[model samples]
Target: MPDITTSAVAPTRLRIPRQRGQAPGTSPSGPILREHIDAMIDLHPGGLTWRRTFPGTLDHIPHARHFTRYLLADSDHRHDAELIAGELSANAVRHTASGRPHGTFIVEINRTTTTITIAVYDCGWGGVPRFGRLFGIDAEYGRGLTIVAALADQVGYEGAEEVGHRVWARMVQPSG
Candidate 1:
């Protein structure tokens, strides 16, 4: 594949028209309001942390995956992070308004000495994923979180799509 970075980055912009009264950024419950933000800033932790915003479309998932792969290239959880990144990014593309025109999602990676946390923040246009192990072998979709939970040391959803839905997973190396 051509260098994804150097490749003409035009097709990622959506040409689809927006619907009337339906804003591009919103939670399914309503317009994202304050009081839902679980805002916390890292105080320059000892390792690496990175964040980026990408157009919420299928084409951009690989970019996020690639970035995650590059960032965790040295970690024992590199493969787990990459898979979690791909699954989370694809879920954002498929289940949220982030996939629409003018919609976007943010990818965040926080790596410490023994763990890497991967998160995808999407414009919440759908129901928050629930924990019921909600899947079946015959189903064609909806196993993102299940896979994430299985692979990660911890997993969670924070903030509404109104404030942006944050789905995160962390993978850690076992102590010696």
Candidate 2:
């Protein structure tokens, strides 16, 4: 693949066209916000990026995790990477249009000398992926993103509901 760099790219210059009267970066189905982000200062681009598309379903969550673990088998962050992959995949299926009939989600894993970035691209229509407050013990939901944020050094998302959403988490390690 060609080398992709974000050093010269500006988020303001990248805009997604939406319906008139609708929010600039929103969709009619849900409120997915676009984040203004810069590349992680500690991580460089031009690394090996592995991508896979999985049918959006709860049963496929393990597949996503397994794929991540397989890729990072020799790394110290393998467990964390797999867990992050599973959480993001679960969110895509449970909260986004990706769960609809025939919908699918894409998992992209990027590995640099000192960083591991995992991004999940969903079919959209779900609200912003944010860290939810730890609810009461009886609550069964709302912890996926929280756990992701805790394990990742950097986390954010981009894309509109009309198109799709890419929720990503980056785990950084000190370069030798």
Candidate 3:
């Protein structure tokens, strides 16, 4: 996977485009969904991107899910997106340094006419994510990525342990 930690724009602040009649700092969907977003870059002229930073904690997993749900509400894959966000965010908090006090993780969603991608960025303490060998239904852990892969057309990650990691899952939209 490409290392995004070295990107020049990694430190830039994310900006949500306003609707024609919308006020500054407000979401078109509803009242301003306040978050500590730090960076976001458009994938392309035709794609849409939104991202937010959350303090890494198990309690914040629902916030990440809600973010995905709000963004993909109009799409057919909203449920999958929400699940993916929750799983990835949980992993970041449970496996990475982002779980430490004062640590943070980022949730980003990129959408195009044919695809939707959800990603979780962590502070890079844990090793890369992987799908462990199949576990029986009674296994207590180790199935998040497997579930994500089952729902996504593609699943992978970027960056390194020292810098950070962005675990992402992308789903292709169904034909009309």
Candidate 4:
């Protein structure tokens, strides 16, 4: 993971274009919705780490998903990582400040020999994520966290909504 120990010199920020007349964060939040998309990618130290700031627009969710897939192309957990990335991006765009006009979200994909970690950092103005599952067909959408937890060997979140919050998932795979 990239270092962000201080706010003065934190993660790199980049601008993403948005369409006019769109109500910014009011777009319906879901998967596979592609609006105009733009983002920035930052390569970190280990060379195995990649961080990007993407516009919180709904269309960018697919961009995030594809970004994770591209990063993990040679890994065994590529598919799982892609799904988790999409879900996390959706949450960031729908529930956090990332969804607002000009708002952005951070996506970091770090891989080691035996484990891969995907972390999504959202603008800290919305509700933080938690593990919640509604057991019903018509219970809206509440299985994202649960799905993430079930797929990743380790899943967790930290930080505050004031500055930002990060939701992460870690997968461990054996080298056959």
Candidate 5:
């Protein structure tokens, strides 16, 4: 593996084309999204792994699993691939506090020579993650951050300035 101390670099933005006229489920949005993520993975000098998480709701898991399988089939490191389904499921639970039961979440993976980053963007009720003291020890909720922290070297939120919200994790890759 490359030196893990190398400074982190921003991912190169790829132009994702909008599918016009195509119905929501008819067009190739999922495949296009997967392709964009694969391009990012290709930029990594090291091997790459990817996974996706969906809403906890039964309706969304199929879509999530479909996209995740597409990405994982092309991955080189399945073992290190972050298990994001649980995190997104938790976010869905939080967002559904309103009466609406429908939402979507996406997870993308990318890496550089030494660092790997996983990002989960959701159309959830947006807010920064509440850390310690926000939830009690016996509480079943609020454990998403703990899972993220344990699995990731660093984690943070972004997109407060935008419509949707994204949570990301960056970690040093283990040598192959």
Candidate 6:
């Protein structure tokens, strides 16, 4: 396992290219992005879990699912993490329509010898609940963050000024 530390500043934001048609299975752009994410996940102290971000569109869900499967198959499956990916994909589908310019979503995996951290960022208006009290236990509207919080060892949010926001979670890795 590797020791992990956060930089004083976040890593430089990379610009993800948006294609007009569906994403290519072997295109340079998509594979390049996937490699970057894989590298990040692999650097985790335990092992590379998975990290990815795609345009906030309905079409990206399949890509996300594929990536998640690829990552989980290499390790003990962490189904809780999948919930965050699903929520992010669902939000992207609900918010970003065809006429809208491409929106962005980012997923990062940070690892320490004993813990794994997952973070998701999106370029949408920041309106998701940061606190758990905002919704009822049975409320169907907004529970994604709540679920993330429940499943994670820790959970929080980071504001991106006027650009957007990020939701992050840290969870303990299952010991083999």
Output the number of the lDDT-best candidate.
3
| Candidate 2 vs 6: which has more lDDT | 2
Q: Which one is best on TM-score?
A: 3
Each candidate's TM vs. the true structure? Answer: 0.70, 0.72, 0.74, 0.71, 0.53, 0.59
lDDT (10s digit) by residue, model 2, range 1-176: 99955454222332234777997656555422222122332244566789999999999999999899987765668899999999999999999999999989999999876688999999998877876566778878888898999999999999998898999999995432
Q: How close is candidate 5 to the true structure, as a TM-score?
A: 0.53
Q: Model 3 has how many clashing residue pairs?
A: 0
The weakest ten consecutive residues by lDDT in model 5 span 73-82
- Stretches > 4 Å off in candidate 6: 1-51, 92-99
If ranked by lDDT, best first, what sequence of candidates would result?
A: 3, 2, 4, 1, 6, 5
Show pairs that collide, candidate 4.
Answer: 35-59
lDDT of each: 0.74, 0.81, 0.83, 0.78, 0.55, 0.58
lDDT of 4 at 102: 95
Position 147, candidate 6: lDDT: 70
Better of 1 and 4 by lDDT: 4
Collision pairs in model 6: 2-45, 41-48, 42-48
Candidate number with the higher lDDT (5 or 6)? 6
lDDT of 3: 0.83
lDDT (tens digit, per residue) of candidate 4 on 35-59: 1111111133343678999998999
Q: lDDT per residue, candidate 1, 1-176, as tens digits? A: 77533343221122233567867864335332211211122234555679999988899999999889876654557788999999988888788888889888899998665667899998987668654477778997777778888898788888875766898997775432
Put down candidate 6 lDDT per residue, 73-172, tens digits, no spaces: 3333346656655665565445433114666676666554456666666675545535465777677777665676777778777765366566677777
Question: Cα-based RMSD of the predictions, in order?
Answer: 16.3, 17.2, 11.7, 15.1, 10.7, 11.6
Candidate 4 residue 56 C-alpha distance from true site, Å: 0.6
CA error at residue 133 for candidate 4, angstroms: 3.5
Candidate 3 per-residue lDDT over residues 54-74, each given as its tens digit? 999999999999999988765
